[model samples]
Target chain A: MTAAAASDTAPLLPAARLRAALLADRAATLTQLYRRTFPAVERHVRRHGGTAADAQDVFQDALIVLYEKALAETLTLTATPGTFLVAVSRNLWRRELQRRGQHPTAELTEAHFDELPADESEAAPALAVLDYVQQLGEKCRSLLIGFYYHRQPLEQLAAAHQYGSVRSATVQKFKCLERLRSAVRAAWARTTDLLTA
Target chain B: MRPELTRLQLIEQHLLGPATPADASAWQLQTLLDPDLAADAAAQQQLYAGLQLAGRQQLRQELQLIHRQLYGPGSAGWLRGAAAGLRSLFKRRFRR
Candidate 1:
């Protein structure tokens, strides 16, 4: 992917270019922000139960959140790139889950979990949670993976799954858990009983 | 032979570890973790091993996808969708 070849074909749709084309006064700041923060946002959006479609949507939304916050010029960085990104991704996921009326757990954005340093040693080996969740059916697997990994609220789960409400979706959550359990068992070459842990 | 447990029981222990007094008394999950099931420890270990393997692989693939999406002209597993759009644009004659 050569940038020259890319520009030769289509204008860059990057944050830097988009800010330069659309906004006033904050172009340089936006570019620097894009360079500094966009990667973290992009990576988290990709892994946090979003498809490329979802990834693009979440990344853009988080950027907008940052943009709006920059009004105060206090969008400080208490956490590293990964934590900030995962936090935003988790919130977006919760909102998406809520819209669907599922029971997304408040546990989705566990501050303690996010506060942990982003050590490659502790980071799950996969490139992104999205790719791992891809191993399952998109609709079911994605929602389940969202809950499994991020604890997206049940209301959000229902919305994402299109269930009637949180309770109805809760049953599905159990089922989703069963499915995840099965997946882990099969992948591990373990029997169903062994999943008891 | 290993014993069976409910989804809730499994999840509680899987993510939270060991039966809480409340969990054991209320759900009767205490007996579910039978010592006979101890024989199945290998399976439990295997499940964790698999989850980690799958998780890491997924993460690797996703990062690659992001990398391509950012650096390349197209997204992962989605270039085919763009090709047709691009083909039509090529047909739109710029001023001769």
Candidate 2:
């Protein structure tokens, strides 16, 4: 089938379904999103002096932003999911241009693109925190992420991790969180010290 | 629950919850009166935000794997396969 025909027949997931897919990390739905939305992002990026590779990077970051919003349960789609992805890609590419000290192409006017909400601006620091999360060791990392990120219940986590009971799992989760908090605080302190020094 | 764990749970509830107005008010008053509690609350809030970021990171990795499976070097996608074939054909012809 032609690309257009394929897209025409593609199942467009509704907003709730999209959010659910993101929350569950469902590969099929996410793959469908990529197939449906990426071409438009690629075209827009190429038109604005970006390579296919640039488009890929911007599109990936946009998806991360969308995923974050979904995790926060704050995703409110104002248009088709494809259009939202394209708009986010546009914003991201525009930022990339500014970072590289190049003017955005005239076609990338502010009027033509949607400004992402302020919460999206926290992405960079959040990524840094993600690095800290990686340092939290495997057990703590899994426990914390399973609870907070995956939203898994204590009983389920207990079964998966072989904890004696839900109570033990809850205690473990609390301890892991405390460890994470301490580690992050120490890391932040070191960073702050470096800045001062 | 232990006192510290109970406090942590309260802070978590305030940060991410199910927190009732009364619970919120109590949390605010406690944090206001106790600087350490306030700091702990902030750190806990940051942790939740970090968890969301980590979740996004995981999802991004998953999407990237899907992208590679669909379009990367060894992908079975027809366009990429055709492009690779054409490139090799040109290289072979030029080298002759």
Candidate 3:
């Protein structure tokens, strides 16, 4: 079956509904996506001499890219979600091979080349700072994440988190952000010192 | 509001929102004159990037959990049945 026809049996989800389900962490919708798209990714990876575990890793990263694009309201699908997922998975797997110093047997088509997401070279530093986020205490972490990443409205966040008012939640979010900024600064300084030492 | 918090808000607005050209230029001038403000802005920008990365990481973990539930040895009965059907179909189509 063609990649577009791969997930034909699974009901197609509207892009908006898919975004909402992902943002809300709806398990059933995510399960449907996983069921629909994963097989193509697995087949592609296996054809390239990669293991099932490698396919899983590449598939997961592609989903993360898709999720972030949806969150940013920047997802512009020119094909079925299954096709898009397969293309992205192929690109990610190719990049992985290159990173491992293995030449990919399959050349990336122009379409696949354009599907690559953001550069991950900076991800290491960002991930290092993410470790500091955990040290900000659970309340702060949740407040910042709820506001920034989840994009929850301040009024809604206030009610959900038991703050007295939206203003209170806003204040708390700012404070949490400040704390995180300080931690990141400290981490940068430490890294600099280590490099210089 | 505390001056620090106010400055933080200004930096956030400059980075994350549509600042009027006036506001943007003013911010640029402020950062140019104030090294500390520039440093704070850079750090805040990195923090935003980190938050984005963290969000993706959290979503990946959630997806991984779903994947495990669907494919792991203890997957639900109906899911296992469906998977078996799909596997057979793949085998048939991909057989050399």
- In the order shown, the candidates' Cα RMSDs to the true structure are 17.5, 9.5, 8.5
Model 1: how far residue B36 lies from native, Å: 6.4
Which candidate number maximizes TM-score? 3
**Residue A179 of model 2: what lDDT?**
79
> How big is the positional error of residue A157 in model 3, measured in Å on the Cα after superposition?
3.2
Weakest 10 consecutive residues, lDDT, candidate 1 chain B? B1-10
Fraction of the native A-B contacts that model 3 recovers: 0.64
- DockQ, prediction 3: 0.49
Instruction: Tell me how far the alpha carbon of residue A14 in candidate 3 is from the true structure, in angstroms, after superposition.
Output: 4.9
Model 2 interface CAPRI class = acceptable
lDDT (C-alpha, whole model) for all candidates? 0.47, 0.73, 0.73
Model 1 chain A lowest lDDT segment of ten: A108-117
TM-score of chain A of 2: 0.63
Name model 3 segments beyond 4 Å from true. Answer: A1-14, A26-28, A97-120, A123-125, A186-197, B32-35, B77-96
**Residue B82 C-alpha lDDT in model 3:** 81
Cα distance off (Å), candidate 1, residue A195: 20
